[model samples]
Target: MPEIAGYRVSRVVGTGGMSTVYLGTQLSLGREVAIKVMLPEALADEVSRRRFENEARTIARLEHPHIVGIHEVGRTADGLPWYAMPHLPRGHVGQRRLTGDPQRVREILRALLSALAFAHARGVIHRDVKAENVLFDEADRPLLADFGIALRRGHGTRVTMTGLAVGSTAYMAPEQARGQQVDHRADLYSVGVLAWEMLTGELPYKADDALAMAIQHAQSPLPKLPPGLRQWQSFMDRALAKSPRKRFPDATQMLAALERVPLSGGSHGARLQDFAYGAAARLQRLPKPAWVAVGLVCAAAIGLGMPWRHLAEDVADGEAAPASSASSPTDASSVSAAAMAPGNGGIADGGAATMHGAAPLSVADQAIERARERMRTGRLATPNGESALDSLLEAVRAEAGHPQLAVASTALLDALGESATGAIVAGRDAEATHLLQAAARVQEAASPSASARANHRARVDKALRARIAIASRRVNRTDALRLVEHARVAGLPDATVQQLRAQAERIPDLQGRDPGNLDGMVVLDGATRPLAAFVSPVSRAGYARFAEVTGREPALCRERISLLRVLDRRDWTTPGFEQGGGDPVVCVSWKDAEAYAQWLGQRDGYRYRLPTTAEAASLAAAGGARIVSEWRADCTANCSRRTVAGASWRTDSASRTLDPDRGYDDVGFRLVREL
Candidate 1:
């Protein structure tokens, strides 16, 4: 209840294993604040203390608006450590005060992903991304919180123990479940799963225990989803893929996918309600088959002459079809058969009888045929000696006789193969590859006589070998060479193998560099100024901000204010400016950095951006002289001196800088812009 460090801790708001969060108020700013105090147990252990210190240092370096801001860290009278952050008004999504509307869910998810993308760029991985870790402001804007299990590059020691997965099991990525080394992709997977839950009100996977859930994540298929999620199925499939490479590489890409899904429905609730009502209405309606059977039964009973006049009258009236003469044998027989059907008289099994006869073609068939005809007339036109390939294929498939079908299919397949080869010759490699693969699958599936089948297979084999050679010449030379060698050993034609080998030889070795690097590069704005910072290497101090800013207890208010300014200045650049690195640079909060990066990108050519936490670490670890010097003992002394001159700085002569033996305070940074 006592006031300290310009804030009054009213009461404990929440508690975690390492710290207790208190609802507090900043007297000067007249704003609510959330203060977290390190548990006494953490302070008692040296390793835990170091980790706590590192968390504070890492949190202070991030400068994104979507991230929770770290205001200050101090010690209570009893020597317990605590840190202050902006008080978020809204609680976790799982608290269930009222079910949030879909729009709110989507908005919250978008903000969280954006924040995560920022943190990831700077080499920080929030191993725990879940509803509980996200908070909302008074206006309901989402703020990503709780980076307790965040992993920093070049920081080998983990805050948590081995075999102990840090994130909620429901959101853990497959690799994380397996306890394998993970990267930014794991976070993307979690975001995707969370989004799925928000939309459908269900998790993609579920189990009774953590280990079982992990196993299910690794081995089981995705849970059966409600209808109408087909649009998002492809993205979900990729995101939930067991392999990390298959998921979107980061949260930014996942955000792009989410944006692509149209938000046409007013909100999730309204759409769901409409759908439910529509389904109920459909169930209430009389089935068409029942009516058809009823008509048939009435007609038959009339023909049988069992007080039949009324039956005939009813049947004719209901169907609006002309009544048949009872004297005609054909009409009588047909009527009797119809009446005996189960749907009408309950005498015959209508479904079985209907199946015995050739089923009438549905209206849907006509629609499909019309579409096909239009396509044929437009893109598949036969002109100037060119034949319509799709038309030919359709005609072949429709042929009644096996021999005729075999001949026609073979001809069509051969023509497609030639077309594919022509495309390759014309230097359209992508089209050629697609065409060849399609043709191969078609030929393999076609039905033909044994001799014809063997001949077609031979032709396809030669074409496939040629296509493989062409592909090998383009890229992936090693894979191509192995394929060629395998084909040769399998007794493929020597001429084809030789051609493949020759093509493979022509491919330049682009090995060691990533083939997908160009695709992965972020395009930033040209008009915006790019802000950049560096992260500090994580150290083993208690998970308290006091350990980060002061490296020990501060004796004067001047030192505390200086630390605040340092943190405030850290927000100048956005998270997008940093690239992934494994070393520490200037760290700011995630939310602040995201705002700066976004603003800069908008003002510039959209290329001005912040580097992810991972990217920042990468640049730092690259060992440029400037970066290395920025973290040196000499550099710290120089920076400290410069700050004193540049600002109205104060120092306590009686108080000494704490832990002079440790190097945690040597973090520094620089800024950059695209040329």
Candidate 2:
């Protein structure tokens, strides 16, 4: 190991393509540390060197219980970039003896996902998430390590070399492997690969070289787990989906699915059936020559008077298994025999093949067939992995550039749209929104025209806005809050979410302070105060309630039997025209309006005042039309004359100054509630 300042390098512990990790002791702290030094060649370019430093600085700022923290970062004596971290001597999850322990797997996945969730929340994506990067402490707790290839949100795709993505091919998301931009979901995909490796003791896809491996990741069908591990198929399917949109939206969602994974290993019969499924799948993969050779060997052994059935029974008793094999079959011979039973099409459990004279089904064909089956079973877009839409989406990816790609994608989109419609009708707007979003993602992936994409997006937005409107109208505060959360979970735009949130948040203010009068209100968003106003001018019934409760008298009117005004024998009770209780109460002066508003505010334990000229204009712009000109709090000349706003029965002018102490035949007022 190269010498480092303030530390004594002992020996090289591990090495990667870009960096070499050494076991060293910091002299000042007297603690062992893992010093990771960038390879001289990897940092030869100025762009690479700068990206390394920028990522290092970003990583150093992250502090989480399950995330490895950087101790110090600097240049080595040879001018190579390097950073030191706490040395975890217990090795990593790759070396751990898992023994198919689901509990252990759950624990490891949880810790790593927690770390990822934290880092992602801070705009960091751990582009390289593999078993080797998960280190174990003394307590066997997994800590996510090796963020050397991490990409900060919006840090630009130039952080990596021009044509290469920075992640292991076996664990890399397809999008990342294509040298395309990636987000946190890419890390979740890698985690799925790691989980597969842990449970199956092998990578899901394999090839002779890196490029071939990446192609397999991009094109191959998702691998099926061994029968005993079938409970995780749903989780695995989502985690390994070709499209990130189909996968768990984030680390937290993945963690939730992980937690829900069944802990019990199911009944023996179910396991045997699963084993038969696996055996059939394995048999289907064998070439014709291999199958013929196996048949010939069995025939010869039987013809030579070899007791093959007895030998099979002996093997079934577990006497002839390989010592190095970790998989000890419990009843394999019988299950394999059953897997090839007659009239079963050389398979079991409706497995992928039909064994017709035609060639065997390709991976994409199998995926499409599976999707059809799922659709038949009414599993279009649920249960994450086994859904019809999920199968169709993966098929689209596996058959990229194929003629049938469009067919499969169209099916997927149609299913998603139908499912979303169903969800909306069922009042599951959040689920509906998720489905619509998935449809949009599918269209985008297909590289639709800009107009097509925009049209699809507009449809989605309209649906979400309708849901927000539904939530906004919820009479109960709790129901409104729940719907708001649903809107957020549905992945509504931030602006839309804020709108729904504002409405939901005002529920308590409206219900508690203005019970039985919650309807017909408009919220003015972004105002300093949480303010709402009556949608129309306050009606005769509302004014009458205030007058009755406070025993307030009607004001002198422009045309009424009053001493100070025109004696037209009319007041608020009769505004010189026949009117209903719901109609605007005309012939009310600004002071009478003010008194009624104050009385209503006192009755409701809320502050109610006449709308300012600006507020009234906003209400009108928002479609809160008024039948009569409303009184406004705006005034001039020391409040001698108050402003009247809005259209009236007599005129459509925006505003006209009126005397505060006098009433008019065509004037009324609305109340603004301060929340």
Candidate 3:
């Protein structure tokens, strides 16, 4: 256990990549607090150690309900830099009880945005904003904490946040991820990601690797959520735009926009604390003397070129007495590098020339014409994601040689996506995601025009989507152990793999022991394991597995489509497929014979289902009387569900050969299960 200055360590609270938080009681004040300490291993380097100390000093100055205020900043006896703040007992937003309630999600979003807005007005930029940084009080009022890598206006580079790359790549703004000079809006982009994950109960874009996930954040389209939640699409759209110009102007605008949405759901009476958590009102309540000290720090930061954090810390320790600054904090720039686009005459890095800006409409028309001409002539017909179709359009437009960013970033993303295979295969998804995202941000930054971005987006979407599919394969094969191993190796989310396993286990199998079903069941001998199982009816769960394997649903079984799809179709309203997995499978399907047989053979250690006519008749006779007509797997590629086992769909009908390729409506299947 570690203790903050004047506090006795109590218990472990939480941990992160660089630091661990602990619960402690102040020895002198007799109050509980959160003690944050950077890991000693991370402090071995000079810069990292200093940066940790700097974070403590930075957070000590902020005074707002939504922003954590540090009461003590000190180094531990072992020399580890540490700080203590008011203990928020409810834990983090994405952890513990705040995980998925929608209204709480909204409240958290509102609180964070308000906090960020307040910070920005104070000329502070919280460079890193993520769910882990958001804490809550016992009453569930959200608070934005952790300013380890914050950038203050007029501050010199004590330790550059860009060099350290302190934040999680998944939540970084496009510009921040690209290592560009940023503004307060960068925080808003991260807030957008938080909003999406909060509302949907999962992140919008997921990949086996971090680089790929980052690429998704940079280039992928806005995540498509369920239809009912589509009303909030525009809100998320503005929040997550790759270009900052497309997003809310600031956190204040975002907070207002979010408040307008009528979305509901969270804990009862949670809204009662809305007023208590207002950052604006809290800021107004702060004594005039404190604002005067903060104002002095800001004035010195701009006029004398000092680190704002150091000056602000002076005020926190009761050492400031200067008058308030002549200028207001609103004077700080709101727009960032992401919001500003290169116009016709803009020059990019390395002295490269970019977009020869003609009229916006004129260039768009000309670009479209050139694209059509290339398609008409069939030369360089298809565009790839690396450079995509930009080269062709550029060649035809004005002989401009090439787009500036196109040359710069396309080559980079091409190499990144190509190099991420090892990580994806080795189960290092997070690393792979960051690499891919870096490239995607570059590509996003390069597109000079909306048309260019659209074209790039379309091409990149196809490429990235295909990549995600490979990263996450949906399989329901006999060798489940191998599927489990592959999924683990690919770094697929544990939840997804667990869900698949749970679904597999629910299918009822004999588990190598006789169920002793006196009604109609026979577990064939191991020597005849090829038959799969001998059963008269397939359970609902068994048929569900069948659909997963073959893709299409069993004709008369519960549908494999989503709930929305079921509601959309009028016919499904009547005689719909039963959702319960234990019920017998319904409808005639040629796939039933093969699917049912395979699952049983794999489930139990014996074969009972895939037997031919002679083998099936011998084993099936052990059970009681059953329907004579049923589908079986005894045909070739062009075979139909019409007649398997030389039988018809009608009961007691034996016209198996009469229509081997024709399917009937009355046929059904009997399947077995496994754990």
Per-candidate TM equals 0.42, 0.43, 0.39
Worst 10 residues of 3 by lDDT: 334-343
The lDDT values for all models are: 0.51, 0.68, 0.53
- Tell me how candidate 2 scores on lDDT: 0.68
Off by over 4 Å in 1: 1-4, 45-47, 96-101, 157-160, 264-675
Per candidate, the number of residue pairs that clash is: 81, 0, 32
Candidate that beats the other on TM-score, 1 or 3, i.e. the better one: 1
Put down candidate 3 lDDT per residue, 398-443, tens digits, no spaces: 4443433343234333333333332333334565455445434444
Candidate 2, number of clashes: 0
Better of 2 and 3 by TM-score: 2
State model 3's lDDT. Answer: 0.53
Note each model's CA RMSD in angstroms.
Answer: 19.1, 21.8, 27.4
The number of residue pairs in model 1 that clash at the backbone is 81
Full candidate order by TM-score, most accurate first: 2, 1, 3
Which has the greatest lDDT? 2
Q: Write the per-residue lDDT of candidate 2 for residues 28-143, one digit (tens) a residue.
A: 55899999898899877766676678767766877778998887776788988888889999998888767568788888888988788778866888888998889998787899
